[model samples]
Target: MLAITRSLPLRIPTRLFSTTPISLSGHSKWSTIKHDKAKNDAEKNKIANKFSNAIAVATKLGGSDPSHNVRLATAIENAQKNNVLKKVIEQAIKRGAGIGSEKKNVDTALYEGVGPGGVSFVVESLTDNKTRTIGLVRSAFTKAGGSLSPTLYQFDRRGLIVIEKGELTFDDIFEKVIEVGAEDLEEIEGEDFIEIITDPSDTGKIADELKKEFTIKEVGISYIPKEDMLVDISDEDTKIKYDKFIAALEEISDVTDYYSNLKNEE
Candidate 1:
């Protein structure tokens, strides 16, 4: 649920955003494949499934009503955007709302580790089988020349909110956010965003307030790198090795999200 933001100190090259698309260009090929793969991958569909599960969980925690249950409402909205079946979403809401005898068992787990080039990696997983998921996460890190830590203190947790450009002024957002207990706000690339640093206790309140103003892309606790790694792995062999390591980590079914301290160009 964490929104990972990478700082772009310099603008991406204009050539990178060419209007006329050409075949065989690196950007074109990668973009084409990325779009195709995202549509075809079963693992990607798991996101919708996860949202359904979240709806159930939220409904169970609060009531089944969206107006009363803010979390459940947000989860349902996200599920709809991802094209989740309406029936499934309704079933989840009912189950969560306590209309059924289904037992709810949603677990949120975090895994911290160091990957190749000593880059810090934080993985967020949602599952019922914690033992199995943790083992799989550990194995993936080990196979990728990395190891997991039982305790990771090198990262900070912060609330991240993203809004489209010109939607709201920073002052309006800031004043409303502080009332909900936000710590800081940041603006990125003409897009309005706010980073609320609240104690774990205040997260829910802050989320509810922000959702009233801007569409919530994602919401959850995140492990942010204290310092980022800027290694020069421009060579093909080294790039391939790092790419393999990342791919392996991403392949784990239980790992919903992964974050790293590595820069985009690295």
Candidate 2:
């Protein structure tokens, strides 16, 4: 079913499946606490794994020297912000650079698909085994009522820099970024932050420049949807099913980051 909320379109599937129970009412304080904690745990793990993979790729591609390697430097900086422990970052570097006994082969991979509600998605990963990574990614898409495909036509590859607004005005950040190869600037309305977009290859360079002006929150290459679709999950049962589906997707370790065209209730 297709519906419109505000200016965005919502595509609902004809059939839905099993759902985990959840309370949407504000009255369920204890239930909300538990729910929030569980979500936090999921996000924490997801972020940690993503940085670990990024560190691996940076090391593998440009050696372990953060000073000399721009990608490694950015990866290290991003990891530290996510609270990835120093020891863990060092080990990931070692694993990628083959510097110690923990040496292992690792490489970045990506997969694209049409997820539930006709939303497109891209899955990024760093894996020692390509076959294993492919299998897990494909399985996630299938279980989400989606199918994996090679097409990424719905997305654009860009370097994204996330930074806090702090004391700087929008024009202040824009001026700095424009001089440093930024392609676009967007204020995340209502959120005290902004997103800077640049040529994928110029991300590291631009991020370094922005760091001098604002607190860098995140920097990386991503597949952003050219257009976004809002999925109406006003129905409690559908929201639960979607949440459970995403939780399952989050459980896959190799999936460093997954971009979706569907904007749904978290």
Candidate 3:
């Protein structure tokens, strides 16, 4: 799944999986929350375990060969990016492929909700405990000044590809992206991004085509904010309330990626 971050002062949470200090400029509060959670050994371990589980699921659906299975391949890439051991990735693929699980009962699910100031949120989970996961998500939304609903139509699921600005020209990438069926492209200060509006089916092909021209900084399917809400709270208050909301959401083990339309003042 490709996740897109518009120029809405929002950040994707990939930085949480790394050790580098997050930049204050262009920093997304959700990204900060992820980084903070990863700083704790216990939380980091939990996230790693979840990734392992996802790997297992992906491998099971498609054989362990990353070369042959794009989903499995991407999952392996993410696991490696987060420093998951090679053995763990391999093991997950084996398990997912049903080499070990005699009981096939696991089910994967995704949940969508609204967050603070009506920000859209999407949570992806691979669990045997669907009831618990949904309950936890619902509670988070209620506590965060939002609620759950079936109307996910407000947002569009799209393929997001991010690359360094220096790697390619905007026009060149834009032309190629459109040729490959991308919906739109945007240029930020030093990063170039492309959003491909695709049915769930065309995501992989678009991703593969773009990678041939640019180094993929991050790629995942994500719910993008249809329209953003700008809040004018004091910096201190923004930090407090926004951080609190994000912290609470990130703690939910079932919430994989959270997207919001809320923009923070730099």
Candidate 4:
């Protein structure tokens, strides 16, 4: 159960919005993916739909209160960024929390499989109709020269928390985060945030501890690659094929996330 803090302020930095645990939605899966998913009108609509499901799911899992419910808070933030109407987000919360007659049977489904060139994929979806979602997702994979699998040994589901790069230096964050049991702290040079990776089970607890000081930009369960596949850019054919394949998968309305193990080094 989630409890919303009624009197505290927890506004996050604006630049911290991207990816997920990849969190909120599918904003920050990879820098390449982000660049591929430029926000046109169609992309914005896709984001809106994804966020609606995310908000509903977060509320159902935690509760409707954004303050106490980390997932819902993240969902709300990402949803607003995608131009999802405030009233719509509130309605989603209501439906998710079963607050009124406006109820929805939303559930999350994950498909682990391999995509083109043996790239591992963990497609996460929030759907009201699992049958339809599965068919479309599988079809997308099949068309992309891939097949569904029961397990994703190539991927490890982990807890990823992203905090904005505030006044605190890397050393400052490392000292504090390591004390609280973070597995690793990642600082990408020229990035606006530092990412902390934690054990999946301890995510909520550690996030709470960090919130005592840091403004959390995103937090959630993420399908991180056990080993990232290095894609050589000289192979333009492979890149083009994968890009088309990913676009097809993302076109499926229910497929809110497209997490892959392949990392095309820019």
- Say which candidate scores most in TM-score: 4
Using lDDT as the yardstick, the better of models 2 and 3 is 2
Instruction: Give the 10-residue window scoring lowest on summed lDDT in candidate 2.
Output: 3-12
lDDT of 1 by residue, 131-225 (tens): 99999888877887779964356566664444343566778877876787776655653345455555555666777777776766545445555
For each candidate in turn, the TM-score is 0.67, 0.74, 0.69, 0.78
Superposed model 3: Cα runs more than 4 Å off: 1-40, 46-63, 94-104, 163-166, 192-197, 228-239, 264-266
Across 56-111, the per-residue lDDT of candidate 3 in tens digits comes to 66565556787765656667777788888887776666656656643344566777
Candidate 3 colliding pairs: 1-220, 1-221, 2-220, 2-221, 3-220, 60-96, 60-97
Error of 3 at 32 (Å): 24
State, as a TM-score between 0 and 1, how close model 2 is to the true structure.
0.74
Q: Report the number of the highest-lDDT candidate.
A: 4
Q: lDDT for every model?
A: 0.62, 0.69, 0.61, 0.70
Regarding TM-score, does 1 or 2 come out ahead? 2
Candidate 2 per-residue lDDT, tens place, 137-236, comes to 7887788777887557766777777789988798887888788888887887688878777898888777767777678766667666554443334556
Could you tell me which residue pairs clash in candidate 4?
19-27, 19-28, 20-23, 21-222
lDDT of 1: 0.62
